[model samples]
Target: MRITVWDLPLRLFHWLLAAAVAGALITINLGVSWIEWHARFGLAVVGLIAFRLVWGVVGSTHSRFASFVPTPSAVASYVRGHWRQPGHNPLGALSVYAMLGLFGFQAVSGLFTTDEIAFSGPLTRAVSSDLVATLSRLHRQTEWWLYLLLGLHVLSIIVYRLRGIKLVGPMIHGRKEVDQTVPQPRGGGVLAFIIAVGIAAAAVWLANGSWIPVPPPAPAPAW
Candidate 1:
């Protein structure tokens, strides 16, 4: 029997976010010419993250934050190989949250990050140079954590595949082959999704400093 584990919105969000993040990283290594594209990718990322956060509150059964939050016993049970579910397992849930949290931090920090040249975050004008400097440094340094998280994610996928557990297929097509009976997700309809997207769009606009006041340009120094 077929059951929906991931929904269309969730799947699209997942893939788009992955592409955006990867693109942003790649563009970072391409120098000044690509910074504009990098900023566009960052905007997409922020919007996606905002959507995901809102959707977590009112999304499909498996996609909700409540669905994947792991308890102590849940972790122990997973470690003991006694945990079974149609959605994310306990260990996987931790990775999901860690990715969301860290990415959220990255998006927020990047709002004030600067390149000390032609590139400046849209919101840089709203913050002090010292604060921007700090965030910029942190942003540069914390990317390694994202790399570590990505490494662990791929490792876990390989580990699961070796164990005869197929996790990736359901994310792509929203159906999984489970021997046990599980309820299909019922939330995340068009209306709820529209609301989530609206929220995300607004967040992106704000992140771009659409409403923030820009400081006046400094006068040119006389030679």
Candidate 2:
């Protein structure tokens, strides 16, 4: 039977984030002025992730973190084929969390990173030089890991496709055919969506240093 596994909000978040990540990665390869765009894309990611965190709490059943965040016992049970429910499998849940963590770190770190040239993060001026240097280093170092995780995500999709599981279709259309009893999403209407978007916008604003208090101008140099 066909059942709704994802809601409009979750689906939009997924695709929009995918596009933002792709845009940021492309900017990385392009270099030069592209890094400016890369930061924009990264900020978009922050908004999406911020909304996702909120949605995970008060969103739909399948969209909720509680539905897919697995414990050690749950993972073991899934490995043993004891888990037959819908939504993310235990293994898939780990990958999902890992991806989110990676993107979250990248977004947060990018706020304070700088390339020492034309490129600087939106909030780079908000932090000390030492802290900016630290985050800048971390931002560079974590790019490789993010690529690795993205590769794994793609590989998992391919593997699942080969095994007759159509993960992509369900994510796009928000419905999937399954024998198990999969409950459709509840709540998460326009009001919840507006709230989530508001939170995301606020995060983006803060990350951009809109709320950071500006320091007073320095006095004239003593001759």
Q: How well is each residue in 183-206 modelled by candidate 2, as lDDT tens digits?
A: 666878888888999999999998
lDDT of 1 by residue, 1-223 (tens): 6788898999999999999999988998998999999888988999999999999988989889899888999999989988877788898899989999988888789889998988999999898889999999999999999999989998998998999988788889988877788777889898999999999999999998889876689999999
Give the lDDT of residue 24 in candidate 2.
91
For model 2, the stretches where C-alpha displacement exceeds 4 angstroms are: 213-223
Candidate 2 whole-model C-alpha lDDT, 0 to 1: 0.89
**Per-residue error at 206 for model 1, in Å?**
0.4
Clashes of each: 0, 0
Instruction: Single out the weakest 10-residue window by summed lDDT for candidate 1.
Output: 176-185
What lDDT score is found at residue 85 in candidate 1? 79
lDDT of 2 at 55: 96
Model 1 lDDT, residue 156, Cα: 92
lDDT of each structure?
A: 0.90, 0.89
